[model samples]
Target: MLAVQHCNNSALHVDEGFSNQTQQVLGVAPVRCRENLNTTTNPTAAGLSMTLGIVSNIIALIILAKAYARLRKRSKATFLLFASSLVATDLAGHVIPGALVLRLYISGTAGGLCNQSDATCHFLGGSMVFFGLCPLFLGCVMAAERCMGVTRPLLHARMVCTAHTKIVLVMIWLLALSVALLPFFHLGTYIYQFPGTWCFINVLDNTSITDVIFVLLFSGLGLAALAVALVCNTISGVTLVIARLRKKKCHRRSAKSHDIEMVAQLVGIMVTSCICWSPLLIFGLMSVIRSYSGSMGDDLETYRTLMVMGVRLATWNQILDPWVYILLRRAVLKKIYRITTGRSDLKGSTFRRWEISSFQNSMKSVINRN
Candidate 1:
């Protein structure tokens, strides 16, 4: 989360230099148009989004930690740790960069709060990239872990020990950090976008090799991760369906429902993530390609609204991720619901007791449906 804001000064300086000339030539004030958009829509949307995101992410972290604590020794595995890491990253995203966005909403301009050389701008940009990419990379890792669990159960169990999980997590953060900090080191560049509410790598601003490389890394890696997640999830879902069909001949209904539910949940999560991110990924790639061919500037100016919309859509992914996890964990969610509604069995207990084997059983259930 700390690496997202490592923006370069080039785009910021250039945009500011051209602000007046651009308005005069185009007969439309670019900054004023953006300010109008922000004044009308940013406060309401940013307020709701940040408020909800912060609260939900905190709740998710608590619930997930509680669930992890309740798991019996037999249920403890690398997946729980990976899951916790993902949640923590999402929480940081909301707490750190999301807070900065709220501040920008209040300050109302990149000039005062996010000057080119401002530490606040750099921090926000770096954290945004770090948190955003952490999820994408971690999502891929989670898919691979699930795939191995389904296809090579024995090998997966033996290889993915606690130490290996920790190592993998450390590697993930290191890589995310390296990518996020590249702009600060001058390997690439970062800049505030048109609206001044956020900053990120200036992928659409130039045609340099550094820009293309970063753009490809950002969009390509994300798309690839989503693809892997989709494929792996589909394979696991099909395997579960086959198991269900085989068991149905023996008159087992319970496992059938569980299998169906698991498949639906996996498909739903993958689909939602794809829908939320696909537009930004597509437009980002298009921008890179067109910029390389010297045909991007006019198109970008013409479709600035669409580009901003893509960024807005991408922002929702981090917010929605934790909810997906919580919703999928039916038992945990039930416990939370009960507690919130004052109907919990252990009203004053510090921890809610859950069946230790539930999560383990959930993973192994596809193979143990009988």
Candidate 2:
């Protein structure tokens, strides 16, 4: 009789376990796991997107390497090092997480992994945060470095070098990794996001003080970095303009032109990062606020849809970032200008020399003033 009772209890527990899994699969589980139940229904789209990202970043890396080879003897080598690191990080961002998602889709277990493997889910979630935030941080760093170079040439020359820049890059990666690892310490949670192809920090609802803090930290740092880049870039740009107005010579214009080119790239980085990352960071904060205020009443689905859209938008930053360096340089812009205006003579024209020389003189004036 006891044996029969034990068998019945075992059967009952098995049924309960199956029921819980079913609920989770159907999006009827707790709010934490209630993302859209559709799991990589369109593998083609996932595959194509990852392929394009991987290819573009690879091309960008190649271009950067060639440029670095040419610029190794130039003063801009430090800046190129930072740019190369950012591209490498973005490449890893695409490869590591992209490979995992592709594996899940290929194995026909896209949605089931989160339910079956906690470690896999956590790593995916952390990658999402780490990659998302690293570019923004690096953008700020690049902008600040350029700003100092333009506005305080003496101080910049004394302090910024390739070795120091490398140390800074390592520190930036460590900082991002530290934040990504917080969830493992019970400071936050990572769960499968909608369509069940990726995992990220849970932004749908608040469950603990640590979770709220983690979300705030991620979004807050991103927004703050953008803000700093904006200010530094603005000041650097204004200083350049002022220097240009103060100087009238054409000698050393190449140097000034190079400075302008670097600043221009920084501006491009700032704009791309703002457009790509703002929606997601803003949505994260809004979601938290709405959860706290009980205003998510009937718009939970809308919020989820927006979150997915935001994530998709953020991914574009990685792809767009490389192009900023590839296309915004002096050589490329001059070629494009010549093509559009049918002025091939612009390349070897006297005006081009004056333009370069004037830029160099203006830069000198600014440094002297500093």
Candidate 3:
């Protein structure tokens, strides 16, 4: 009986010991968590970025909406359709992620949203993927559209009607959506980016199969699209320059200045689009290569800084694209002025009509020359 009592007492002591150990572990957990929180995020920087993104996207959206309002049903061009689609993606990419970041920043939490695998994290990551790619692909489509307009004017006119453009836009969005959702389905992973401002695909200096496959595939596809766009833009620009030169050679004094200006404008759009997207993609490819080869080096700080800068640069595309559209499309600018000044002047309407007519006349000349 004494032995039995001792056994029961021993069991009680063991239970108490295990409970004490658990309590100690629990006590240490919060401290470790606090340390992690402090290290992972720069809340001030995040807030600043989010605020800027929010404000910029808002202004861009307002301008686009006002301008889109002015497009008469008969004048809905493919370029305008694609521009509207670009605005939608920019809105989603900037506003949604920016709002979430602001919420987390204001709540005074650090690092990720909730835990790493939480709903908010997935949403932000997926959104960053979707909206990030949307503009790029849409830009390519628009570039291709322009190429068609310049190179195959009759076919482009027949094929790229308003309904056809809408169908193409739908397809582009669906493709981007599919790619973005891959991470959520375990094909890839999305983790909180450093300084904890945003989330992106696995861009660490180490690689997994998923990371390698996704990065290479998407980067290849994106680069191909960008390349196609660059080529199209080059061809279109050269064609325009040649056309302008031919007109100058003929000594057609009328509208020669406008032709030169328009050619310059098209070249600028092409150059700007390429400049905005190229660095991030190139850096992303290099990072992936280094990760696979295990040559990432000891300077994680450099890698982190470069990654942050690359992301910011990529985001500049979203911010700048609307302004590019506004500056290049005279109709959009006219609408903005009218909206801002609340101008109901007949002169404004007539002037806009004249601008549209002039653009049509220019397009016809280009086609005829080609």
TM-score attained by model 2: 0.84
TM-score of 1: 0.75
Off by over 4 Å in 2: 1-35, 113-117, 248-255, 347-351, 354-370
After the best TM-score superposition of candidate 2, give how far the Cα of residue 273 lies from its true spot, in angstroms. Answer: 0.6
Query: What is the Cα-based lDDT of residue 88 in candidate 1?
Result: 81
> Lowest lDDT 10-mer window, candidate 2?
1-10
lDDT winner: 2
Winning candidate number (TM-score): 2
TM-scores of all models? 0.75, 0.84, 0.73
lDDT tens per residue, model 3, 1-370:
0000000111122244555577588884221122123332345655555555556656766765765575433223456567667766776666677777666656755344312445766787788777767877887787787777766767876787888888988999899899889876677677666555466777663467787777776677677777877787778777766765775699642333333333344455556656766776777777767767788887555776676677777767666665665565555555777888799673636345446656677677668768
Lowest-scoring 10 consecutive residues by lDDT in candidate 1? 1-10
Per-residue lDDT tens digits for candidate 1, residues 70-172, read 5523324455677678778877777777667666656755433232335666677688768767887777787777667766767987787777888988999
Residues 1-370, candidate 2, lDDT per residue (tens digit)?
A: 0000000111122244666778889988623232233432456666676777788889889988998897674557778888899898888888888888777667755543323327777888898899988999999999899999889988988899988998999999999999999988888888765555667777665445666788899999999999999999999899988776566364323336667888889999899999988998998778766766668888876886777778888888887888888898777887888888889787666348646665566567568768
Is candidate 1 or 2 superior in TM-score? Answer: 2
Q: Sorted by TM-score, highest first, which candidate order results?
A: 2, 1, 3
